[model samples]
Structures are given as C-alpha cells and as structure tokens.
Target: MTFYDVTVPISNAMITWPSDPAVSITGTSLISRGDFCNLSELKIGSHCGTHIDAPSHFLENGRTIDQLALENLIGEATVFEFKNKENIDVSDIKQLRFDNVKRVLFKTVNSSYWKFSTFKKDFVYLTKDAAQYLVDKGIRLVGVDYLSVEKFESQLAETHHTLLRNDVIILEGLDLSNVERGRYELIALPLKIKDGDGSPARVVLKST
Candidate 1:
C-alpha cells in the first residue's frame, strides 16, 4: 500500500527548460494586507515541471491534453534504472523485455540533477533509436527524469516525434531519484486544457 509521489515541486527556483517561461508566483491578495482571503497568482508554461507531452506537442493533427485517454494515463507501469549511460539508446533498450509492459519510466543519472541548483545541459535522455524501439514494441506511455525526453537542443527533435507521431504519451520532469526499479501503478493526471499541447501533471506510483 506504499505510494511514491514522483512529481517534482514547482517553484520559481525550479530548473526550467531554456527558452521556456520561468515559473512565477505572486501574492495577489493577502490576509496580512487586510484582504479577506489569501490568494496567489501563478504564471507557468504548459510544459513546466512534471508534465505530460500530448501528441499535439509535435504532431499537427494529434490529440490535445484534454483529448488524451485516461486509460493511458493510469495503469501498470515499470520503472527501469539505467547506470553509467549517457543516453538510453538502442543497445540499452534491447536489454529489456517489454512483454505486457505498456508504460515505462526510466530512472537515470538525470535524477541526480534535481539536487543541483541549475539545469544540467548534459542530462541523460532518450535517443531517437531507442524511442522508435519503444514505439515499435507498442509502449503506450514513456516517462523520463528530466525536463525533456529528448537530448537537449536537439535540432530535429526526432525522439519526441518518433513517440508522439504514434500517439505515445511522454511524461517528463519526474523525480525518480527516490523510487526503486520495479513494477507499480502509475497515476498521472494532467490539467484538462483545451487544445493544449502539454500540461503539468500530478504523478504518483503505487505498489502493485
């Protein structure tokens, strides 16, 4: 009955992808200032910390966040740990068995980047070939421990395209540093934004 809350906390200080809007929070109303109730305003990108990338994130005619099926967001998942790998490539993908696995989360060295004060440009990510392998194997959802599933500054964004074009859900910015490699039930619920390409999500894992 144990649960793992793998979502990273959102804050103005949290590491964000370069060029993306930084998180901003301000107290619009405060009891200390004689306001009846405390109210805060938040300004954040749709692709902020701990989020899901809808197919529309890359595909021109793909489904938006609200249109995504809940069946794909909540289900059995497997967390796999990779050690000493710069990126998850075809060779690394070949070592695993996907027999009945629909959702997979990769816990890599990137998880340690969460402890740093800044974003690590060299964080571990998924290569295009590895992404294609997963799609070929019929993976419904893919999760990673960084802001992006693809290599930073990738010009083509091939990894993202490979998965998104096939309707595979991409979950990113996960704090998998404390979670062990094993099977669990994944519950990732994103804000139901209309025509949204991406949205931050509250992700949790329950022991199966």
Candidate 2:
C-alpha cells in the first residue's frame, strides 16, 4: 500500500490566509541548550494549515469541530483534477458520478500556487453553485487544496452556508500536488478542541 501525506507542514514561516492569525513557534527550553527538555509554544488560527471546518464556521448554531463524526473523517475519497476553470460550477460536477463517494477532494491550479513564498489571493475556489451541487449530491466531506473552499470575493457566502448547513465536513490547505485523481482511503483528523468551529488537521491518503 502507498501512503500519501496530503497535509502541509505547519511552521511559523508558512504562508497563511491574509488577516488570519500568524503562526508562531517559540522554543521555551531546548536539550541543546542544557535545558531539561525541549518545549515549544505554538500559536495559530484553528483554521491554519490542513484543517477541517465544522458547521459553526459559517452558521452561528452549527456543529463544532469536536462534534464531527470520525466516520466522516475517514472514508473512501475521490480526487477530482480541475483545470482552466476560474470557478467550479454545478455543471462541471454534474458530469461526475458520485455514487458511493463519501468524500471529494479537488486538485486545481490552487495547489500549484503553494510553491510561491507569498499567499496568492486569486486562487481557484468553489462557486456557490458548486457548493449546492455537492450538497445536493449527498457529499459528506469536501476537500480543497487551498485556504478556502469559497472564492475570495464571494458575495452570498452561499458556498460555505450551503455545505455547512448540510453538515459537510470541509477540509482545506491540502497539498495535493503529487496526488492524482483516483479512489483513496482518506484519514483526516482534526484537533478535538472543545466547541471549536474549526481545527488544523493532519490528512493522509492510502491506496486500497
């Protein structure tokens, strides 16, 4: 079996979404410095790096990260390779047969932009129609290789609301550059923060 790590390495220098909290790692004690043990302090937004967004992200009374089911976090997932499309549309997703698809991950040009030092504002994102389409298709989980699943200037915030309202687990900041579109076993586990709207996750894929 081959295992592909889809999560990005979180670090203080890693590029994050604009206006989001910056990641900081400070070593309080180090064995190299003759200290008892190495202890580091980590500070960052819950939504940083490879993360899972719960319903509370967009809905005030929605479910929190800890409330998500483990069954939804681990399952058979399909990776869809999208190109040249500024916004993923309902028509685009309609062509694919989502039968037995528990989770879906989109690999787009947005994954390529991760190579740059700075964050790209115009990365490919899901449109409102696409979000509704996924929800309508009974998709339990949706993953994207960018900071957000929705476009930057989305006016309706429909993409988020539509998915979250339906309890669709949203995974973002995935590094899918080396991955190809196919069926894979997905293991995406986020931090069990109490009542957290979202939390960073370590996602991995394995061929069955």
Candidate 3:
C-alpha cells in the first residue's frame, strides 16, 4: 500500500486569498535562544493551506467546522484530471461519472501555479452551473487545488453558495501534483475549532 499527502505546506510566507489575512508565526520561546523549549504563537486564517470550508463560510446559520463529521471527511474519493480548461463549466462536469463517487477532487492547471509565491487571480475554478451540477448528482464533497473553489472576483459567488447551501463540503488548497486520476481512500480532517467557518486540514490519500 502507498499513501500520498495532498496538503500544501503552510508558512508565514505562503500566499493567501487577497481577502484573507496572511499567515504569521511568532516565537515566544526557543531552545536555541536559551529557553527551556520552543514555543510559538501562530496566527493564520481559518482557510489557510489545505483546509475544509464549512457551510458557515458562505451561508448564514450554516454548520460550523466542528460540526463536520469524520465519515464525510474520510472515505472513497476519486481524482479527476481536468486539462486545458479555463474554468470548469457545467458542460465539462456533466461528463463526469458520478456513480458511486461520493468525494471528487479536481486536478487542474491550477496545480502548476502552486509553485509561485504570489496569489493567482486566474486560477482554474468552478462555475456556478458546475457547482450546481455536483449538487444535483448528490456529491457529498468537492476539492480543488487552489485557494477557492469559485472563480476569482465572481460578482455573485454563486459557485460557493450553491455548494455550501446544499451541505457540500468544500476542500480547497490541495496539492494533488503527486496523485493520479483514480479512486482512493481519502483522509482529511480539519481542526475542531468551535464556530469556525473553516479550518486548516491535513489531507491524504491511500491505496490498498
């Protein structure tokens, strides 16, 4: 059996969504600095790096990150490779075989942009119609390789609302460069932050 860690590394210099705060890690004590042990204060957005978005992220009175169940976060998942697409449209999504696939992760050109130091304004994202398509097919979870699942600067943000409103778990900022298109056991769990709209997650895939 082999395992793949699909989570991106989070650091103080990592690029973040323009609307979100930057990652910050400050040390209060360090063994190298004559302290008893190393202690650091961490400050970062709930959505930093590989994270899961609760419905509360885009919906009012929606479930929080703590409410996400382990069953939904860990299970069979399929990786879909999308190439030469500016954005994932309903037409493209309609062709996906949704049978018996509970979780879907898209590996797109956006994964290449992960090597950069700046946030990309044109990362591949899902269209509102495509988002609805997943909901229509009873998709329980959706994952993307970029910071957001929706298009950048979308006027309506329909992509996010449509999925979140329907209780679809949104996993974002994944590093799927090492994985191939196929079925695997997904293990992704976010921190149990009370009332958190989102939380950092460590996502991995295993083949048995």
Candidate 4:
C-alpha cells in the first residue's frame, strides 16, 4: 500500500492568509544550545497550514473544530483533478462522480503555487454554485489544495457559508502536486483545540 502526506509543512516563512497571524516557530530549548532537551514554541493562527475548518469558522453558534465528527475526517475520498485556470465552476464540478463518496479533494493548478513561499492571490478557488453542488450531492467533506476554498477578496464569503452552514468540513492548504485522481483512504486529524474555529491538520491518503 502507498501513502501520501498531503498536509503542508508548518514553517515560520510559510505562506498564510493576508490578515491571519503569521507562523512563528522558534526553538525555546535546543540540545545544540546545551539545554536539557530540544523544545520549540509555535505561534500560529488556528487555521495555519493544512487545516480543517469547522462550521464555527463562518457560521454563528455553530460547531467548533473539536466538535467535528471524526467520521467526516477519516474515510474513503475521491480526488478530482481540475485544470481550470480560474475558479472551479459548476461545469467543472459536473464532471465529478459523487456516488458512494463521502469526502472529496480537488487537485488543481493551485497546487503548483505551493512551490512559492508567497501567497498567490489568483489561485484557483471554488465558486458559490459549485459549493452548493457539493452540498446538494451529500458531500460530507471537501478539500482544496490552496489556503481557502473561496475566491480571494470575496466580500460575501458565500462559498464558505454555503458549505459550513450545511455541516460540510472544509480542508484547506493541502499539497496535492503528487496525488493522482482516484479513490483513497483519507486520514485528516486536526488539533483538538477547545472552541477552535479551525486547526491545522496532518492530512494523509492511503491507497485503497
């Protein structure tokens, strides 16, 4: 069996959402420095790196990250490759086969952006209609290669609201450059932060 670690590595210089807190990883006690043991400190946003967004990320009085169902975090998932240069519209989503699939991940051109340390504003994202399509198809979870599922600078945040309100788990900041289109067993576990709207996750895929 083969496995793929789709989670992005957290680093002090990693790209992040414009307004979110920047990642700050510092060595507090290092063996090289003659400390008792190697220890580090991390100061990052809850939504840093490859993370899962719960309903509380967008909806008021909604479930927090720790409240998300584990069934939705681990299961068989289908990966769809999208070559669209712009947003993922309904047409692109129409090509997907949603049968018997509880989770879905999109591998798009945005995956290429991971090579750069700077955030790209024009990365491909999902359209509101496409978000509704997934919800209508009974998708329990959705993953994207970039930092967000919605288009950059979106004032309404409809894509997030549409999915979150329907209890759809949003997995973002995945590194899917090496993954192919197929079915795999997804294992995405986020930090069990109490009252966290989102938390960084270590997402992995095992060949079925």
| TM-score of every model versus the real structure | 0.98, 0.98, 0.98, 0.98
lDDT of 2 by residue, 99-173 (tens): 889799999998888778898888888888888989888899999999999888677778899899999999999
Please give the distance, in angstroms, between residue 55's alpha carbon in candidate 2 and its true position after superposition.
Answer: 0.5
Model 2 scores a TM of 0.98
Q: Where is the poorest 10-residue window by lDDT in model 4?
A: 82-91
Compared with the true structure, all predictions reach lDDT values of 0.95, 0.92, 0.93, 0.94
Residues 1-208, model 4: lDDT tens digits: 9999998899988999999999999999999979999999999999888999999998889899989999999999999998856889888889878889889999999888988978899999999999999999999999999999999999999999999999999999999999999999999999999999999999999999
Candidate 3: minimum summed lDDT over ten consecutive residues — where? 150-159
Query: Of the candidates numbered 1 and 3, which has the greater lDDT value?
Result: 1
Q: Flag clash pairs in model 4.
A: none
lDDT of 4: 0.94
Q: Which stretches of candidate 4 lie over 4 Å from their true place?
A: none
* Candidate 3 lDDT tens digits, 1-208: 9999999998988989998988999999999979999999999999998899999998889999999878889999999999999999999998889889989999998888889999999999999999998999999999999999988988888999999999999999999898999999999999999999999999999985
lDDT tens digits by residue: candidate 1, 120-167: 999898999999999999999999999999888899999999999999
Clashes of each: 0, 0, 0, 0
